[model samples]
Target: MSDVAIVAAGATRFDERIPRRAEELVAEALLEAFDGVKGLSLNEIDTLVTSYFIDARQVAEEWIIQDYIGHIPRAAFRVENGGGSGASAFYTAYSLIKGGLSDVVLVAGWEKMSLYRTLMANELIARGLDVDFDFDVGAIYTACYAMMAVRRMHVYGEREEDFARIAVKNRNNALKNPKGQWKRRITVEDVLESRLIAYPLKVLDCSLISDGAAVLILSSVERAKEITDDPVIVEGIGIGTDTMRLGDRAEITNFPACRVAARRAYRMAGIDDPVRDLDCAEIYDSFDTVELQTYEDLGFVKKGKGVEFIEETEIGGRLPVNMSGGLEGMGHPIGASPIAEIAEIFWQLRGESCNQVDGAERGLVHSHGGAGTAVVVSVLGR
Candidate 1:
C-alpha cells in the first residue's frame, strides 16, 4: 500500500453557540485547510469524506456539503461510528489514498448540536446505545461511562479524585488552546465540587457539548511533498469495536476494542513502547475517567495504574497527552471530536500546537465511540 500523509489541517473555534449551519461550519474549516495548503484547489480533491451524526435537516448530508463547499462532481460519502465518526471518516480517506484509489482526499467532520435542547441532545446521543439492553433500561451515555468508572474504582482502588485530576489537567491545558471551548484553568477541588452528572462523575468531569467542525487534507506521500514542505504522515491506522451492551463486556474498566485497535496501530507504526515512543497523544476524553482508562487501554500505562500515569502526562513530562484539552476541555461535537484530535496532532508534529511539545515527532490519536464500543487509533509522524 502507498503511504498517506496529511498536508493541511483546520478547525473552527469550539463553542456552545456558533451561528452557522453544519455545512457552513465544514466549509469554513475546509477554507482554512485550503489556505494552509498553498496551490491546492477544491477541484483537485478526488474524494470528500464527511462525518456527522443525526443531522435532522438532511439525509446523504455529504452530498449537500460537497455542493455547498463547491466541490461538486467529486466522489463523496458519509461515515458514522457514533462518537468515533470523525476518525472513521479520516481512516476512509487514508485508505483511499493508500490504496492508490485517490490522490487527494478531503475529510471533514461537524456537529451543529446547539440547535437542540440539552435533553433532546442527550436523547439523540442515547439512541446510539443498545436499545433493548441499555436505552430501554433508562441508560444515558454518561451513565454508561459512570458504570465503568464505578467498576474501575471498585476493582482497582481508583478514587474519584483521580478522575478529578484528569479534569484539572485537561482544563488547564485548554487555557493554552485558542480554539478550545473551556479556557478557564480548573483545579481538582473545582472538579470534585462540581455538580454530579452521574455518580463518581461530576459536571466538570464531562466533556463540553459544543458546536464545531474540523477538516483535514490527505494525499499520497508523493503528492503530500508536492503540496507542502511539512507533511504529517499517517504512519499507521487501526479500528475495532466491542460489545454494544455495557453489561456484556467481561471487563468494564478496560476497553478491549481500544486495546485491539492500539495494538494494531502500534505494530503497524513499529512502536514498541507507546509511552516512550509517542511524543504526545490526543485522546478522546469525553469523560475524565475515560481519559484515565485510555492511558491503560492504549498501552500508555499498565492496567490498574492509569491514575499514576496522570503526572507523567503533564506538560513537561515524558509524554504529554491531550495538549489540545481533549474532548473534555476542547469540546465534544461527537463526529467532530476525533477529527479535531487528528488536527491537534498534525499541528503538534509541525511545531504549531498552541501548547507545543518541543521536539515532537510522533503523536497518537485515540477516539472512542458509543461508550467504548467502537475505537479508532492512528499514529502520525513527521
Candidate 2:
C-alpha cells in the first residue's frame, strides 16, 4: 500500500472562446503542469486518466490527446460522471497509486464548450438529465437547479438574496485570479436585476459557458518528494450517487448523496468537524445557489444555516470557500472544472494561491455532478 500525493498542477484560462482545439488546450495545460517540477520527466507518468463531457464536441477525446502526447501505447482511459468527471478521474488516479498498480499518474480534464452558442451549449448539457422525464420536458440544467432552489425556499424559507450573495462573493474573488473567467465585481442587486433564466435563477446566477483544461500529476508519497519537497497528500476521497430524476427523489431541498459522500471523506480524513479541521474549501458551485446548499450537505453548517454562514466564508472568516472563484466565477468547463478545484487547493496548501488563505495546511474539495445526482468529496493536506 502507498500514500498518494499531488506533485504538480496545471490549467488554461477559462474564457468564452480560446479558438484553439481541445488537444492543443490539453497540451498547453500539460506543459504548465511540468513547469516547476524538478527531477521528473513526462515519461515518468505511468498512467493517464482523462475526463470531459459534451461528446458532441469530440467523441472518445482521450485517444486523440493520448496520441498527441505520445502516450498512445501506455495505460489510459476516460471518465465521465457529468460535471464531477474531473474529480472522479482524480479519484481513479489516486486509487491506482494507492493500490500499487501505478507509481505515477496524470489526471487531465477539459471542455471545448464554447464551440456552440450559449443556447445550444446549454441544450447539449441538458442531455445529461433523465431523457425520459426531465430532458423530454425541456428542463435545462439551470432549471434543474432552479427547482431545487425554489424547493429550498418552500421548505427552509431561504431568500433569493441569499443566492445572489454567493454570486457577488465568488465573482469578486475572481478579480485576483488571472485564469478565472468572470472577474467583474457585482452587487446582490445586480444579480437580482439580471434577466431571469428560471423563476429565481437569473442570468448572473448561472455558471458561464467557457472552454478550458487542467492537469494534475499524482505520485506515490516517495515519488512525490522526489518531484517537490512539499507535496500535498491525498488524505481522503469519497463518492456517492442517487437517482437521476428529481421528481423521484424523496427530498429536493438538499442533496442526500452529498452528505453521504462528505461523511465518508471526513471519516477517512479524521475530520470530526469540517469548520474546525479544514482551512479552506473549493465546493462545486455550478450555480450560485448550489454553493449555499452545499454548506449543509457537507456539514459546514446545519440545514438552513447556510445563509448565516455566507459571511463566515469570507477571506478572513472561519472557513473561506471557493477562493479560486468557484464554478460561478471561474466558469464550469465540465471535466476541467473539478480538476481546477483540486488545483486551487493544491496551491492553497503550498502557499501559492492568488487568493491565498494565509497558513493554509489542509483543504477540501466537493465536486457535484448533474443537479446533484452524484458527489465526490476529497480532503488534501500539506
State each candidate's clash count: 0, 0
lDDT of residue 325 for candidate 1: 92
lDDT of 2 by residue, 34-87 (tens): 995998887888999999988985688899999998876789899999989999
Please provide, for model 1 over 328-362, each residue's C-alpha lDDT reduced to its tens digit, 9 standing for 90 to 100. 88898877889999999999999999999999999
Residue 216 in model 2: lDDT: 97
Q: What is candidate 2's CA lDDT for residue 72?
A: 62
Name the lDDT value of residue 331 in candidate 2: 81
For residue 309, model 1's alpha carbon misses the true position, in angstroms, by 0.7
TM-score of each: 0.98, 0.98
